[model samples]
Target: MEFLEAFFGVIGDLTWGWALIPFLVVIGVFFTVVSGFVQLQYFGRMFRVLSSKNQSGDPNAISARAALLLSVGGRVGGGNIAGVAVAISLGGPGAIFWMWAIALVGMATSLIECSLAQLFKRSEGDGTYRGGPARSIIHGLGADYRWLAIIYSVCLIASFAFGFNAFQGNTVAGAAEESLGISRIWTGILLTGVTGLIVFGGIQRIAKVADVIVPIMAVGYIAMSLVVIALNITEVPGLIYSIVTNAFGFEEVVGGGMGAALAQGLRRGLFSNEAGLGSAPNVAATADVRHPISQGITQSFSVFIDTMIICTCTAFIILLSDVYQPGAEGVDGIVLTQQSLASHLGGWTSYFLTGAILLFAFSSIIYNYYLGENALTFMTSSPLALQGLRIAVMALVFIGATAPSATSVFFFSDPMMGILAVVNLLALMMLFPTAKRILNDFRAQIKAGVDRPVLNPDQFPDLDLDRTAWTGKIRENG
Candidate 1:
């Protein structure tokens, strides 16, 4: 076990620490430029698309709003609270600035990947749509490269379904144990039970729960941050200055300088928003929106909310309170955030944060499960296989809660996620022309006075899309 852990740790460090981070930033910038700054051009259209109603009466298909919340559930989680604190502690306050930069370019990456997912989406017999990096690879790239899709599916299942859930469970259990004096075993059991309940019911149940929980948790957390910032209004300008300066090697307080800031910020930012990781595309493809690009636009909004809004809230709470100690041992992850909040609000804020972390982590756990299930479906349709996977996931959640450390789990999972991201990014690059074409078509309709741009598949004769799924045309509403 030790040897395997160390081996995976080396792979993770090499993949993420050295290779993936730079590649992610470069691709993100490339997509941002090639997409004609879609994130900036269509920022308002994102919200408008979120408010648009479903174009089809497909019962299994989720509305665009529900899909947005589902993706938000997956995006906003432990990474927002614990992960942001980790970035700041390791990389200094400047890391937060890089996080913002990555997210800005990542918004364009998200738009491209999600639009491709929708473009290549396959319709199931049950009236649901299914698509993602795996599906897109198979359909868009051709059957000869189906093996690549299979590899992606397997890696996604391992990273999200099994590995990520364990990490989330560990964080939640550790937080509860520290704050409430609860036993890790009991916390694990409860988490396992609740996760099993939601995941067993599948995507619809997951979507329903996300819709209710995401808004409340996001608003409540942001509201708390607003209060904290208001209280420390005098320090706001200096704090912002430090974040910007340190990001560029100007701040002496940063330990490893700008390099550390860039690495940690990009790592945690990708973990939080998952913009180009291809995970959210699974949920984005499920939405029954009028135009594929509409869901893509909505997903871009999700990245903004995850990193820009929720992650910034965590950054402010820690930086404003003066509780963060850079280069200090044992002050990195969730502990830093909890202690900082307690310093400002009260001792009782620890318990409040534990509850918030519970919601945040559990939402992510189920969302991860859905991503894995989608991957499983791509690999094999065996009911027994899925059932076994569910049981295995629940068991891991229990084990993770009781486990002393999440180091090995994360070490293994991080590299797997790196692999998933690379594969998805490569596929997106290959399918760039198709995505750009769809974007142009959608824009043309908007220019023609169409309030809600409807997709007409007849315009794209070269594409092999499921025509029935895009048959319903939504006209402009006067």
Candidate 2:
């Protein structure tokens, strides 16, 4: 067991260490520049597109709002709460500054990758749209790179479906056990049943559930944080100053140096928002929109909500309370967060946090399943194979909840996610020219005074796309 832990530990460090971190940052920055800072240029358009009605009448398609919620379900999870506390514990308050930095650049990366997903999206026989990093690679990069697609699909399945579900289950079970005095076994059983019921209904069920739950939980948690910040309004200026100064090594409140602070911030930020990691594009491809860039802009807003709004709320709650002992032992992860909240609001808030975590974790479990299901469909269209995968995922969720420790799970999943990021980043870089062209085309239409940009596939004859997908546009001739 020790040997296994050590093996995964080394792999996690190497995969997420200096080499890959710089690569991710550079790609994010490169896309931001090449796309003419689309994140900034289209910031308002993101909200406009997200709130607009579905432009396609495809029954299997979802509204842009539904797609955004589904991606939000995946992006805003334990990472927003527990993960933020862990970052501050190791990196100090300054880490929040870097989190903001990565999120800004990552918006551009999200725009490019998600737009590509829409461009290469294929329709299943059932009318549902299917696309993501794997489909993007196969369609955008050509048949020769199918091997890379297969590799990405396999890693994505392992990371999100099996590994991430287990992690979420463990978190919920632990919170329940600690706060509610519930047995892990019972928690696991109940969670497994709930997960099975929703997942069996498929992506539409997941999307509907996310639409209702994500807003409540996110808003409720943020509202709580807002109250805390409101009460401590006087400390806001100093808190902001500390985050900035410590980020640049000007302050040494925490024991670790500036390098550790930067590394931890970037790692946790990427884990939370997952902008360049190629995960959200799976859901982004399912949106029914007039232009591919519409969904891309909508998803860029998701990154902001996840890292900036939700994650910042968590950071503020911790930083505002006195429970955040940067160099202290036994204060980390979810416990650190709960303690910080209780410090300000009283012990009853611990129960409130458990409920919040349950909602957050449950949404993430279903979102993770959809990602794996998409990968499975890409690999093979066999229903039996998918059923087998579903059963396996449910069983893993139960085991993860009842398991005593999640150390091994984190160690194993970290490297798998790293591989997914590397493969998807390479594909995005290769397909950037096509994505850039689509962006330019969308901009041209907007410049022509079109209220909602409509794509014309006839303009890009060389690209492989489903013609019918864009036929629903409200053109002047129609």
Candidate 3:
């Protein structure tokens, strides 16, 4: 375990220090500029597109709405809660400023990647669709990039399935133990059982459960946070000021400095919203949409919803209260969040937080499972391989639950995420032209005064696409 920690720590430092961080900021900025600031222009349009029906009318495939819910289920989990706490503890209030910055840029990044996913998506004739950075490489860039595709598939499975999923399990188990005196192993078993049930049911079923539960739990948690915010409304202005100034302030430099602030903020923001990180695009590809860019725009809204709203809510809950401190030794992660909220609203909120973590983590585990399963489909279509993946996911959930702490799980997972991001971001860079073309197509159709923009695969003769997926404008009221 010590060796594993050392290995991951070394790799994490190298990746964040030299590569992923710069790449993230650069590509995010590039896409945001290249897209003509699409994430902002169609802000209202994203919701309209989200609320609209699946015009493709493919019953077997997932809807744009379900895809949003599923992706949100994955994005708005322990990371938003526990992960935000860690960022504040390590980097202070300033980290929140950086988080907001990355998320804003990442909104454009998510739009491009997810739109590319939809544009290059292939149908299986069973209403199931497969696309991601990997599929984009295969069909969009041709077979020569299969090696990069394989690396992406492996990294996606490693990061989301085994690594991040384990952390979620560890968090849920810890929360259960902290709040209810439940044995971690018992919690592990329970998570495994529930995870197996939903993951084995497949993605659409995952959507069925997520649509109902994720919104309620998320809203409840956010509403509770709003109560805390309201209670401390007077302190809110000073807190926001601190967040911005400390982002590059001198005292902060003397303390932990801007580097730690930027690192943790970008890392956690990516984990929370998953915009440019390439995770959400897999879910986006499954949606049945009249225009691929509509799903892209809709998914972009999710990044804002996750980081700008939900994560900010968690940040405010800690910063507005008396609980958080800069560079606090050994007071980080989920415990800090629980303690802060407990202080604000009393002890019973611990139980409430525990319940919320279960909902968030459970939904995330299934979402993670679907992503890994999608990666498997990219590598192979064998049922036995997928079943093996299911069992492996269940086993990891148990193991992660029984683990001693979340830090170990994070150390192992964070580096894996860095690798995956590099691969996916490279694909995004290479496929930038394709994404831009798709975005232009959507913009042109909307300019033509069409109420709902639709893709004509015939128009994109230079690009390879599955024409069967886009027949015409979305069906009436669909």
Candidate 4:
């Protein structure tokens, strides 16, 4: 067991090493440029489409708003709060700056990836929407890449069932154990019950719950952050200055340092928003929006909210409290943030963080489960096989909650995430022309005030547009 742990630890460091941070930043910036800054052009349209019903004659899937909620629910959980705290602990206040930069660049990454997922999305019985890296891989890379799709599915499921879900559950359990004196066992069992109840109900049910919970939790958390920030308003200027100066390793930064600040910022920022990771796109693929760009734009905003708003809020709360020190001993993860909050807010913080952990951790499981389930659809056709997969996922959730260290689990997950991002990025790059064409076409129609917009995929036959783009369009032959 020790040997295996050491091995995975090395692998995790190898996969998540400093080098990958620059590479990810480059990729994000590159896509943003190629997309003609679609993040800005379609920003307003995204919110408009998300709010208004799709009147474009498409079969009803879940509304775009629900899709946005579900995507936020998936990405914005424990990572936003605890993860931000972890970043600050390791990377320092400057990490917040890196996170903001990544989110800005990641807006493009989010747009392109979600747009590709939108294009390849498949409709099963009852107008259900299903598409992700699997479909995009198969469609863009051809049937030959189906094997890669299977590999991706397996890795994704493994990461979720074993790595993501377990780590999330562990956070919840550990938080409860420390804060409320609730036994970790009870917390784990309770979490498993809550997760199982929602996950078993499938995506539609998950979407409904996210639609309600995500906004409420997000607003409440953000509101709390605002109050804290207001109380420490005097520290705001110095904090912001330190974050920006250290972010670029500027000479003006304290302690005569640049490299450490830059490294910490990039690493924490990437970990926080997970923009180039291709995880949230899976959820974005499920929304019933009019155009692919609509979902893409909404996803871009989601990235902003996750990192810029929520994660940054966590950063402020910690910095304002002044309880965090760069080399602080015996502090990490949720505990570090908990200490900062408690220093100013008192013992009640323990309960607040525990509740936040529950919300963030459980939501992560739902999103993780959905990603795995989608992956499994490509792995096998047998109903029995699928049922077994579900059971295995639940079992892993239990095991994961009690696992010794989430570090080992992340070693496996981080690599898979990198590979998945690369595969998905390749497809999105190839599909760029189609995405741009769709965007231009949609804009034209919207500007013309066409009550019923019809997007003919045949207009761009060279792209071999996938069925997901067709939505509810009925072919003449059919």
Candidate 5:
């Protein structure tokens, strides 16, 4: 186990530090430029789309808003909390600035990939739609690129189910043990059991659950964070100053200099908001939006909320407390946030955040499970295979809970996430021409005074897409 962890850690470090970082930044910048800064162009429209109805009246099809919530729930987890702590501990306050930078670019990257996913989405013929980078690759690019799609699916499964979900379980277990004195093994078992119950119920059920949980937990956490920040409001100006300075101030940072800040910020930011990593599109495609851009723009908001709002909240929570030393390399992950919150509020805040961790991490576990399950469908449709995967997911949750460290889980996940981002970004680049056309069609209609713009299949005759999905119509449900 130690050897595997060490080996993967080295590979993960190399992948993110050397290959993926620059690649992510360049591609994200490219997408942002080519999309005409769509993230900003449609920033107001993002809110407007959230109020629109689902085009498909099919009972099983999710609304764009539900998809947004699920994506947010998936995004808001150990990564937002523990990952942010880890970044600050290892990189310094400057890492927060880098995280903001990545999200700025990632917002556009997400818009492009998710919009393409909807354009190339497939109807499951069971009142469901599905798509992602893999769907975009195979359908948009053709059979010759089927191999690439398969590889994307494999890496997504590895990242979400095997790697990301384990980290979720590990964080939850660690928090439970530290705060409430629960045995890690017992925490693991309880988590696995609860996870199994939800995952087996399928994505629709998961969406319903997310609709309720995501808003509640997110608001609760943010409200608590607001209290902490308000109590220490005077320190915020200096906190922001340090975040800027340590981002470039070599002498004040614990983790050496700008190098650590950039790496951890990009890696952890990608993990948290997931703008370009290609996981959210799976759920985004499931939304029966009138136009692909509707979901795409709304999905971009997830990155803003995850990194800019939620992650920044966690950072403020930590930095506002006396427990956090700017130059000292102390705790990371849930423990640091929990302890810091406790210091600011009271000892009870530790237990409060333990519940937050459970909810946050559990949402991600199921979200990752669904992504893995979605990926497996590209490989095989066998019930037995999916069952086997569920078993493995459960087992992994247990192992992560009982494991002594999250290092192995995180190390393995980092490389897998880098791989997913690489493949998905490549596919997005290849499919950009088609994506541009699809997005343009939406822009033209909206500018022409169409209150609720929809995709017209006839307009996109050259592209092969599910007619059911691009019907150029929306049902007005009063």
Candidate 6:
């Protein structure tokens, strides 16, 4: 395990350097521009679609709100809180600016990939939706790319099972031990039990739990952090100043210089939203909205809420509390976050943070399982294969609980996510035209006084809807 981890670490570092970051940026930027910045144009529509309840006869995958809830459940987790702390500790408060920048582009990336996923999502015998790069690769790029899709599936499954799920569990246990006196074993047992109960219930169950819990936990944490900021309101401007100026290396931050700040910021931001990494789109494709782009727009807002709103709140809590001065040794991971909050809210805050971490970790475990399950379906449709995969996933969740080192959690996670991002970005580039056409048509209809948004893949003669269109659009204005 040591040898393998080291190898993955080296590879991950090499890819994570200038090569992958620029590649992700370029692809995201291209799509953002190509779609005429749909993230901005249709931003209001996202809320409208998410807020509206679906009628009983909607033939879509899941309710728009449910899909948003699930996607929110997946992205808004330990990464937002703990990961933000790690960014500040390693890269300084300056990292927060770059995180916001990445998320800005990441929203565009989310829109593109999610639209593509909807284009090719499958309706299984169980009456649920499953899609991602694997489905898009096969549907758009043809069978020749099926091999590429298989490789992607294997890597995605490995990422979620060994990297994401394990890391989420370990973070919960680590936070518990550091903040409270609980052992990792006890933490893992509690988490594993919670995960088992929710995961077995599938998307509807997961979404229901998320719809209630995600908003409450997120708003609660942010509210506490807001009080902390109010207590130290004087420092807010300086913190913002530090984040923006330091983003371009105008001022020296932690480690050597600007490079460290950029790396730390991008790493934390990417992990927080999992935008270009392609994981969210798996859940996004399952939405019950009338059009894939509708769900796509809603999900784009989710990325913003996860990284910009929630993660930023956590960052402000830490910086405002002044937990780390320039010359002081930094706190690590969730412990640092717990300490920061404790400073504002006292010891009881630590226990609440621990519980929040557990919720974050548990929801992520179920979501990670869904991603892996979809990947398995992309590779093979065999029921036995799926059954075996479920059992294996559950067993790994148990294994994740017992893993002692957070370092090991990161070692497994970083590389697999990098690989998944590369594959997803590649698919997004190929399907950009489809995304563009849909955005244009949707916006044009709204401009022409069409109250309802209709996107029929079959109606588009020039574009092969079968290849890239997800939902059947309304035939006429009612």
**Cα TM-score per model:** 0.94, 0.95, 0.94, 0.90, 0.93, 0.91
TM-score of 1: 0.94
lDDT of 5 by residue, 1-478 (tens): 7998788777777767678768878988998898899999888877754454443466787777778888899989877888898898888888999999999999998888888888888888776788888888888899898999888898899888888788778888888887789999899889999888888888788888888889889999999999999999999999898888878764456746888887778878977888778899998888877788878888999889899999999999987887776545556677788889999999988778888888898888888998998899878989999999999999889889989575364566767777788888788888888888878888888799986678888887778788976676665510
- Candidate 6 structure quality by residue, lDDT tens digits, 308-427: 889999989888885755313555667778788888879899888887887777778778888887788777779898778767666666666676554364465667777788887887
What is the C-alpha lDDT profile of model 4 across 1-478, one tens digit per residue? 7776677567556556544566678878987787677787766655564444442233445667777777787778777776777666666666777778788898888887787787778777565678877877787668888887777777777776557776777777777777788887777677777777877887788887887888877888888788888888898998898887766666333342555556666776676666767677778778755567667777888888888898888888888885777745455767777878888778787788778777877777888888887888777778787677667667666666666364354556766665665555566666667677777776787689953345666665665455554744632210
The lDDT ranking, best first, is 2, 1, 3, 5, 6, 4
Clashes of each: 0, 0, 0, 0, 1, 2
- Which portions of model 4 show Cα errors greater than 4 Å? 1-14, 49-60, 250-256, 402-411, 446-454, 463-478
Which candidate's lDDT is highest?
A: 2
**Residue clash pairs of candidate 5:** 94-247
| Model 6 misplaced regions, further than 4 Å | 1-3, 54-61, 125-127, 253-255, 327-330, 403-412, 461-478
Give per-residue lDDT, candidate 6, residue 262. Answer: 78
Top candidate on TM-score is 2
Where does candidate 4 clash, by residue pair? Answer: none
User: Which is the better candidate, 3 or 6, if ranked by TM-score?
Assistant: 3
Question: Distance from true position, residue 121, model 1, in Å?
Answer: 1.3
For model 2, the local distance difference test gives 0.87
Candidate 1 ranges beyond 4 A from true positions? 1-3, 49-59, 405-411, 475-478
Report lDDT (Cα) of residue 409, candidate 5: 45
Better of 2 and 3 by lDDT: 2
> What's the lDDT for candidate 4?
0.72
**Candidate 3 lDDT for residue 248:** 79
